[model samples]
Target: MIKTSRKGEWLEIIIPEEWDGTSVQDLFRTIWNAPKKLTHSLRMEKGVRINGQGADWTVSLNQNDRLDIRLFSEQDFGIQPSYHDIAILYEDDHLLVVNKPSNMDTHPNSPEETNTLANATAYHLLSQGEYRQVKHVHRLDRDTTGAVLFAKHSFIGSILDHMLEKREIKRTYLALVEGILKVKKGSITEPIGRDRHHATRRRVSPSGQKAVTYFEVLKTDHKQNLTLVKCFLETGRTHQIRVHFSHIGHPLAGDLLYGGKPTFSRQALHAVKLELTHPFTEEKIICHAPFLDKQNIFTGIDPYSI
Candidate 1:
């Protein structure tokens, strides 16, 4: 069998039909049955997790074992703006790192002229009449908030692309989930692939690409779980954090697409920090978003749901 990812990629798997995913996509594509964009990455080959060992699909599966994969791609013309003052973290001649808020797309996809973060950037450019082209280095889902890097031109984008490939960029997120986590810390290592039957779903399969995410439980209340997790992206797969967390049984709160309860209308995940080097200076830059950090998630709200 073959597995698909959230980005519409495929892989071969040799296992029983009843496994979590015979192919690779059985892990992430749950909300919809869409294909994931499966890109290649040599660095993540070593990070692949198969049952207990790190593998790249060369090993055959046993009976009930599982496989995990993660990968990333960098390709977008511009952003789709929600028309808001996007918090600027770091900016220079070559590139800019914007702290993207939730409900704003990193770039425009199927629906055009709908006003997204990318469109806002273009609007900003038009105000100057220079009309700098938007080069999207990274993206965030419309309802998923976090840091997004954008380039002004293709030349600079090339450099940023190489930086991403080299694993120079690190993204961190904080999410509130709906569950009482038993483990203090854990890692969700799975292979992500697209859903062939549906257009927007993903699954985990031994044959799919590789993905690894490390998570830590901060605190938990009766209604929700507050976790301060650091998702190290060995491979920057699409919806990696959301899918992996969902796979681990702790779906983010308000994430209707990934087992999360629709509590806040949008997912409770926030891209709180980012680490990377400047495109030209090579100076390591770390940007932090100001979210009320209580170490314990339940500290912010009453024990009972309001």
Candidate 2:
């Protein structure tokens, strides 16, 4: 495993045995997939070093070599900080995972919006004396509650974005739908596209992007005709889960937009867990968000137990 430490303004990384003889350029381009512009900036600004001295970008690395990169210099926290309470699930120098509450947008739609999760995250970072832009890795709907990942710096943020695109980050969700599925476990392989009739709705389209959702039924409330399901996504299409389940005649209990029953106020969906590989430290990271609603259909269900 790679070892990492935070200095005043630099991040110190110790090369591991497995990366022996890997060229610095290969590490940036192949391993991290850093943008060429950012790589040029790092080289021009002398932001990278080897053993406390300036680094030669083409030189091969050795095990235990000290590689230092200036990543966390104080900068403006781009978004306006909102001083509201937020539940942080996991945090480190490289990443943060926060338990987002219901009825909160992931980020602002306009500059005047301060009641967003990103604004609250900015406030949390400022409290720690770290000033960096709020960079969320993924997003949840306005009413969906769950663990959201954030990158503390742009370098790691870019790496995470690539990981998400490659589907290396596993996102698991817990949802309560209006009916018990005929099959206990199944996968939905459908293409989804924007709904022309509505501005913010998606539908399964024949010529749309490929979307896949895997699900396993966890429990069934036969009396209420509701089913609790654990869903995994292979693609991140807009409203993929909601649209897929709705297409199968089982809309989320409160997802009124897709013709669901008004069994609850908001959609009965929550991002229960996130699993990913740490970009720098090379460690497996798992974050879980417990059910956040007080009077939802999944009250008795324990998401962590799954």
The per-prediction CA RMSD against the true structure, in angstroms, equals: 17.1, 1.0
Clashes (N, CA, C under 3 Å) per candidate: 49, 0
lDDT of 1 by residue, 1-306 (tens): 333223222122233444433333333232112223221232244434565356544333455564433322233434443345666777654467776666667776765655577777666555544345677787777776657787765545665676677677887777777677777787778999875676775666677779887777655666434454445667777778788878878787777877777667777776767788664334677877654322333245332121
| CA lDDT, candidate 2, residue 269 | 90
Best by TM-score: 2
Question: lDDT tens string, model 2, 15-98?
Answer: 999889998899999998988888899999999999998999899999999999999888788889988788998899988999
Q: Which candidate number has the best lDDT?
A: 2
List residue ranges in candidate 1 displaced over 4 A: 1-84, 222-228, 291-306
The Cα error of candidate 1 at residue 215, in Å, is 1.7
- Would you give me the overall lDDT of model 1? 0.60
Model 1, position 112: C-alpha lDDT score:
65
